[model samples]
Target: MRKSVLLFVTFVLFGLLSSAQQTKISEFDLYGCWVLENKKRPSTNIVTYKLCENVAHEDVKFGSKISLLAFNESEHESTGPLACFTTFTEKGTWEFDENSRIASLYSGHEWLKEFKQLDPDEYASWGSPEKFDKLKFRVISIENNQLTVEIIPKQYGKKRTEDSLE
Candidate 1:
């Protein structure tokens, strides 16, 4: 029991340290819930990607001196004739670099494949084997209540709004 408690405390401290290293997002105005618009259908030459219904719901909160950002993605609907493909749902903190306009997202302190619950043959197309622990984004623009970010690795565009609509 003592070991577990110490490990948990260490893990939490690591998260805080990393978050402190990056530029604080409080300088900007991303402090609200922004729902992703449009269905994302990503594909590669070898594997086909399926639409994960009810995709992403992101939230950005602020403290007196610190900021918090969290994103959760889920709702993997099985498509007909495709009994395979890994489910990619990640949730964690986000770090931003205002100078480079880059936002790096960090998943849980540690990644466990077993936590994903997948078949031996099934492979995740999106945020799978890679653990998506540090997904980066190049901020194209964020002004006047508009957010346009291009995800790295493939540069997929994602636009969000404050009105809850596309």
Candidate 2:
């Protein structure tokens, strides 16, 4: 009876350890449309990120949406025509690093030129490539159909290098 009890305890301990291990996130796990949750104004101006096989340009009622395609291409669309001076459809590329859990997005448009042409005052205020071209985010977790990411701050006086998703 003691031997059987010892065996049962060992089995239980092994099971517990196995359950404690975190599962690694794969590209397949990120293959879906995820909407950004706005805690302050949940119903207003919703931003969405769609990481899928194809890019779909859907109209948003309030905010903006970005579609990350399978071939590293991206499309961005925003509402509030007067407020947003940028083009209705902006093309870009995205990269994800599984090891570091870092995702980077590189916009294909010359935002500085566009902003200067559209709104000179706004362009003079904020028209840097650092502000408009590249964005990096560290993925915290994806749970219960929600993706949580933390913005990675840009490093000053250093050139940013891109990492390939593997």
Candidate 3:
């Protein structure tokens, strides 16, 4: 009876550990328009992954009080204040690795240039992509239509900042 009880306890502990190790996010859950919810400034920051079907490239639309930038194959017109804002549009791609839990955004130089203009200090510090061409983030969680990602600092080889989106 003592041996049986010990085995049962071990099994329960193993089950709990395994369940805790399971990931909360999946690749399929990442297909949508994720807007930056915790922006340092009041701006429109959006990242779309497979959001629009039949489109060649993924979409990333970021707009500030001064400028608006888009990375997409199709033309996306923004009316009102966004239209009047200085605009830059292009094509981009994105990918996700479930094993590493990394989401990579391959928006080009224009996006980076505009991003630098939007926040020069941030761009100088950690916002600049180590690879120059791709920005990688580890998907921390996806709950209640919100996605939280932590920037994977490639150059500094450390974790930098978190970006929450909904």
Candidate 4:
């Protein structure tokens, strides 16, 4: 009986230790710059995503529903003078769930609430149940600390071809 109890306790402790390997969201881990890896929009080229410090928000809504911790708008800058290039500070909050392989982005002010995330190697948004008006993205490559993202429209046809992206 004593040996069985000791073995059970040891197993439980081992399980807990291994589970801790999964990473949780941290401010420092999110502080770095993330380039646009979406391949759909190539003209704008690259974007610098910086997580600003000493910023806060309150009572933020996720998607059309749900609530989450508040995060502030960070700086967004264009790479060059391309007509497609434009930059603006994103007003929202971001969270990363490593185990789920997902990153959640919540935005839209008090009225137009919407939240979305991209799982690892996935380009689909799992927010709304609607089929149309859904935005998806694909990552082409990451080189020299730059990311190229490809946008996949919900509708695919001659009207929205790759060449039309130009």
Candidate 1 — which pairs collide?
Answer: none
Lowest lDDT block of 10, candidate 1: 58-67
Choose 3 or 4, whichever is better by TM-score: 3
What tens-digit string does per-residue lDDT give for candidate 2 at 1-166?
A: 9999999999999998898665567656665444433234344322234332233334223333555577776666644458664556666777787887777777745665677778877766653453344667767677655556666666666666665221
Can you give the lDDT of residue 2 in candidate 3? 100
The lDDT values for all models are 0.44, 0.59, 0.52, 0.38
TM-score per candidate, chains pooled: 0.35, 0.51, 0.48, 0.29
Q: After superposition, how far is residue 82 of candidate 2 from its true place, in Å?
A: 6.9
Q: In angstroms, what RMSD does candidate 3 have relative to the true structure? A: 10.7
What is the per-residue lDDT of model 1 for residues 1-166, given as tens digits with 9 covering 90 to 100? Answer: 9999999999999999998665433324444434334444245222111111323323211110112343422111122345343233344456666777665655443344554555434545433554443555566655444455566653335534456322
Window of ten residues with lowest summed lDDT in model 3: 64-73
The number of residue pairs in model 1 that clash at the backbone is 0
Candidate 4's residue-wise lDDT over 1-166, tens digit each? 9999999999999999998755353333444444322224335533322122211222211111112233533322323346554333434444544443333444443223232233322323433321222223343433344333344444544356678644
Residue runs of model 3 more than 4 Å from their true location after superposition: 38-89, 109-134, 154-166
User: What residue pairs are clashing in model 2?
Assistant: none
Model 1 off-target regions past 4 Å? 1-27, 39-90, 110-134, 154-166
Rank list by lDDT: 2, 3, 1, 4
- Cα-based lDDT at residue 69, candidate 3: 26
